[model samples]
Target: MPQNKKFGTFAGVFTPSVLTILGVIMYMRLGWVVGNAGLIGAIVIIIIAHVIAVTTGLSVSSVATDKKIGAGGIYYVLSRSMGIPIGGSIGIALFVGTAFSIALYLIGFAESFNAYLGFGTTISDLRLTGTIALSALTILALISTSVALKTQFIILAAIGISLISICFGSTEFVPTTVHFFSTENAVPLEVVFAVFFPAVTGFTAGIAMSGDLENPKRSIPRGTLYAIGVGLLVYLFLAVFMAYTIDAEVLKTDYNILMKIALFAPAVVAGIWGATLSSALGGILGGPRILQAMSMDKVTPTFFSKGKGQNNEPVNALFLAFVIAEVGILIGELDIIARVVSMFYLTAYGFINISFFLESWANPDFQPKFKVKRWIGLIGFIACFTIMFKLDMIAMIAALAIISAMYFGLQRKEVKLQSNDVWKSVWENVVNKGLKRIDAQVEENSNWNPNIILFSGKSDHQKYLLELCKTVSGRTGIVTNFKLILDKENSKPPLKKIDQIVRDEQFKDLGIFARQIKVDNIYNGIKNIASTFGFSGVEPNTIMMGWPKGIENSEEYSKMTQALIHLDYNLLYLDFDRVSKFGNYSSVDFWWRETDSKNAEMMLNIARFIIASPRWNDTNIRVLFVNNNNVDVSIIETKISKLVEDLRVNVNIKIINNAVEQKTFYTIIEEESIATNLTIVGIPDFNPEKQAEFVLKTNSLFESIGSTLLVKAAQNFNELDLDLLNK
Candidate 1:
């Protein structure tokens, strides 16, 4: 176990997050936002931005409390909750954006430093100053993170002094009245949101330090929520105070209006520099650890993953971060497109919300102590993405595109899978609960649809049976390709090639589910699966099998048939003599036998299922009966006519008045079935003691028919089949 250096909640999480939250935006831009958007609009903007922060904070806390959040902070919670692919994409984007954020702050610091010292200097000279300051901060970070965090306390004190001066001078600089909603000469509402939005963006600064914290799981939630609460109240107070005290014109144009609005102007000036520098320090400190963690995971170059510093700081990672920041400083004028860079952070926040939502929705083991309603995460996800697009749709989209590209690139590296998150288990729970409920409800005949499991031996050889499965299944029913492995060791059979064949475009119109299950024997396998193959509102109610071919022992298949009978399953056995032989279906034969035969109804149902498809559109169905001489033809003909009328299917009925000898029945069927493409027959007997004889006799029926379907209908097949069986 990798251990973290121990620290309390305030130093490890609260101080960093709070100081960053109260950074350069609070000092330089809050007044401008209030001036442009007016009191209420600024308040609205602040609330909108902070609502995202507050909700994200809650989501982060909930995830953190449930998991041991070590190295990688927000990425830890995310990667643990979601998978590595999603987390790595968002994590890398966040690290780059955050690393670039250091350059942004340092540039601000350079300009402010130049103006404060009254030096009339060129932009290049200011760039040099910013580069030097960044290098120094990087060194400080490499020396020790604890030291940098300690320095933030002093900076926080300066911010406190500035806040006091600004509030005190609010009363001193006030006019008698104020306009709450004035937007005279203000920028667009989108621009106003853009200006004020960064105020809440620093909320995740603490999350970057997840590795170094003693009790990260405990500290992250308490510290993050506290910072957001503090940040929200402080922003609201400043927005309201600035609206009433300062003139709108000065607030709009003057970036340093806070200095003039302060009772002690120099203290607020110090606060501005202090806040910007501290915010830069926070990013500089946090960025390396993220890189270091990713390196250890082998997502990035492993050299940066291990630090060489005695204090256990990420020395190599810090230098590499410095290299990136220095390059940004050299690039100069990064400020013009700084807003675009912020897109990555917003996208990262959105992903954070999505991660928590997926965990809560899918993972059954996600028992967080700080549970919020699931919609909170969902709303936060929407809000973040919405705000991102609203600001710069192109930049937001481009950032996502790059992240997705990076995700695929990283996936090629083959990172080890390590998430213990519960999302998949939760999905299983949902499916199982849904199916149990469905099974409990009374099944109606109108709602009945075939959810057939096809046991086609080497499905490739039985193309006719496969096509029949598709046809009988129709659009409303399900057809699954089930392959049983008959091995004692339960080894996985090579089924990918065959799966690809089924998944090919030639069979694209067919909706079929496929799985290969391993068991010691075939009958036990079928029994186990027939009893349990179901999900959500679907269950395997019917078993469709081709005529058994490669069976060395027929007793196993006999047991399988017996098991299905006991389980009350509808069984379909087909003898497919090649699909090419079914070139054009001219006729479908439904054999009507005894008056009370259950097979008659099921065979007719099967015939109906096939003829409804466009493949059999030109075919006419024939209901033929070879009756005994003593039977009345007109009475049975009338009964058949009524059955056809109730079913609404086109059929021609034919009665053979001459009786045939029982010994020559096979020869008679052989001649009569020559013109038909498909013959449907019902089996009435399953002699339990004579399973082998029954199997042989049943197999003999296919010798005369072209593509024969032998159905053994269940006795209690809902109300409709029960009524048919009783009659």
Candidate 2:
């Protein structure tokens, strides 16, 4: 595009907008609106329509001034502000709406031209004329946007003369027949508003030409607002003037009432022709730009991105838009096309307001040169959709469903937006405030949730361990996996960042926060990170690690376990069996011992978390107690059943009698849980002096079972409650 040839405010923005607004709807439909709605009702509809238009115009101006808007005016503003998914959805809708708008204008022109030729308005005649007009307009648009826009000045002059003729022709006030509200035969007010709305939507014609403007920030706000102001004044004046001069019956039935009522009927006819032709030309010029912009963003096919000449005119996109408009014209009904176009414009306008509202509310850096109250965007958003539902509920739902489908489809493409989105800032602000609120509250045992920190030395080698932690955390709790690198040189290797990235990609869907920590000693690193990892509100309450392998690091491992206990962190050591690796995921065995009730409680809670996961939803849970002290087995079973019932968990209880001394506790465990998917066993107190002995005994105890969890509670609180477990 040539820099010097870029358009200024009047030619680029004001002319196109005002011409579009005063096009087909003004000449053809305004009298019908006045006839059905009457004078007072028409004014109300006009006010309501303009309120939405003015607010949206303000929001568009605010957003445009905040950033240097690119091509695809509304699409660029929304996608840049909100993100690609939502932007793509609304962009496609806007493009389709604009294309349909071309057909709308062409159809209106054909209807008026057919009447002027004394051919009478017929479906076949309108379709034939509309198709021909579409071909001519598409050719004109293909030739040059600059040329098409330049001709809008003549259309504006014609509209001016037509308005003058209407005002002067109304020599006598002969109203008093039309009701303030609608008559019994009048269509619903919302239906009337829906048809009239497309008239005001022409303000976006200038915004669609954002790429061709020299200074969009100044041009868009000034041009768009001025056009809306002019369109509003003209519509309101015509509504009152027509209601006072013409009979309601004549206004209601005649689509050519404006020409009949004008001082010089030929001027009104010329204005109608100029208005419809220019508006169709504007749609042809603007719609393709939106498609081209989306194609460039990779939201649509790249073929449409190719443009012709120095202006990079979207010729290919224009052809596609022309095809869509042709289909709309083939439908061959004006009101049906009007309703469809109305839905598309409403969807676009609603999102524009939402985009501006989110930018203003979420981003502190969103300081626009042309400032408006943020609530104005919010109200604009509400009004646009409110009118949509009031007009047609089924169409409203269909429009939303289509946008939603497009949104999810674009999400799959993962299109990366170039500009910064406000969602990140919005979420960050929400989390910060939420954390502060959580910190201000007093800690309670009943409200305890598992915030687990896993120390995985090599993430690739610990996939099963990571999966276990993720399952227990599920969607409610928090899990952070820290890969510890023992670097003696104390250098932060670049590979560590790459490793973190790889880990993220590997488990991206798991929602686990993975980090890499370089340390001189594993024990000190664990202690240091555990001491100051997170804030008071959401600190890690559990430290998870793989079971100790050999005697070489037994002392350090034992000391770290003791330190974690001292720091009030629950410990979980997983002794995963490489062979059986959670066999079939059918059943879980919880070996409950009366001496360590705290560990039992923790084990029960972890079991609940496991069962909550979809993968383990059908897994049977069995709490087993070995009777060694000759206590009543029936009483113990009853007590266990009552406890499980109180926790609202369904589980089977098995109390095995120690009939012989030769069948050891470890032997019973090996035999009972050998075929189970998972086994939960409590961790005994770690004796620093006998670290090697403890590791060997515990490791050998779970050697024959499937994947086992050795849980150790750091502190004794109230018994596990239903609230904490369910949460």
Q: Whose TM-score is greatest here?
A: 2
Error of 1 at 532 (Å): 7.5
lDDT of each: 0.75, 0.86
lDDT of 1 by residue, 59-122 (tens): 8889998877768777767777776767777778778877877776777677667777876447
Judged by whole-model lDDT over C-alpha atoms, candidate 1 comes out at 0.75
User: Mind giving the per-residue lDDT tens digits that candidate 2 earns over 388-462?
Assistant: 889989999999999999999999989997578888978987888889998998876663488999888564448
Global local distance difference test of model 2: 0.86
Between which residue pairs do clashes occur in model 1? 362-423, 363-422, 363-423
Quote model 1's TM-score.
0.75
